[model samples]
Target: MLSLTKVCAGYGGFQALFEVSVEVEAGEAVAVIGPNGAGKTTLLRVISKLIGATSGEIRMQGASLARVPAHEVVSRGIAHVPENRRLFPRLTVEENLRMGAFPRAARKRYAERLEFVYGLFPRLEER
Candidate 1:
């Protein structure tokens, strides 16, 4: 469902990823394992369009995502949860989850998605 071909990305002059390639099929789970500063997060950021790829290509079902904007990425069915978990501290759990589904496409299925989440984590519903 997703493929990266020799993708390269970085912040300014500091290179974080160099020709990294990966492919994930439908219903398949893949893990990106590396030590500190291995560009794992950078790879994700590039895939989600949080940052641009310096070289190579990222394709979602053969559609190029190189020029896609960050906000539009979720609407394309790619969800990214950064390592820091940037949640609002003052917001309730439900509020935080609602914020996650802020994209128009996700919001359309808000009720169904919220119910699914509540079912998965009963404690979240209580919170």
Candidate 2:
């Protein structure tokens, strides 16, 4: 339910993205992998509206996202996990995990989500 079409974005005036496009449908997971200077982050920044696109469009649920801000994208159910783990050091493993599902409604489903994450890393369950 997410897609980008020929999206272009950049810092200052020089363009980092050129005609970039991607799509992720409901129940489908898409990954972006590339070397440095591939504009991976820039594309995400454009999709999430963290950075404005110079051209083209990003859409969610068939609605245009033109000129939307970064914070607004979360309402569309787009969660961008950071590159590095950003768990709170002062919190225990469980607490840190809890923080990741900070949305109150999302938190209601945390038990299932926790089990899913833990199953992927059983060692974490032991921790």
Candidate 3:
């Protein structure tokens, strides 16, 4: 579960999100529908710690993520895959997935993790 309470984030002096609050329960699918410049991307970025919230709090599973950095965000079970494929476009699907296990903590169990990932999404192995 993830919850954002009165989250306000912006770039420089331009505030993109104004007191935004959102809650995502486990196994629930939520969609963020909005036109361009509606802070949809900003909200995701803030939640992922790609950018820090100027004010308000973000909690995952009831634990505060105020001090969590972007790199640590993935380890916290949060990943921000934008609406683009600039990440290793030339690499094969498995290669790209392998790249995600680059962290020192993941390298030890890379093979096991890759197998788990492929098992969860069998299509990944086909690609």
Candidate that would win on lDDT = 3
State in Å the error of residue 62, model 2: 1.8
Clashing pairs in 1: none
Give candidate 2's whole-model lDDT: 0.81
* Cα TM-score of candidate 1: 0.82
Q: lDDT for model 3, on a 0 to 1 scale?
A: 0.89
lDDT of 2 by residue, 1-127 (tens): 8888998889997899988888888889787889999988887777777778889888998999996666767666665655666545677888878866776677888999999989989998888
lDDT per residue as tens, model 1, 1-127:
8999999899999999989889999989898899989998898889889889999989998899877888777888886776466546788988878876777878889999899989989999888
User: Each model's TM-score?
Assistant: 0.82, 0.82, 0.76
Per-model CA lDDT versus the true structure: 0.87, 0.81, 0.89
**Which tens-of-lDDT digit does each residue in 1-127 have in candidate 3?**
9999999999999999999988999989899989999999999999989899999999999999999888888887787878686866798987877777767777888899899988999998988
RMSD of each: 2.2, 2.3, 2.9
Please report the TM-score between candidate 3 and the true structure. Answer: 0.76
Model 3 bad stretches (over 4 Å): 100-125
* Predicted structure 1: lDDT: 0.87
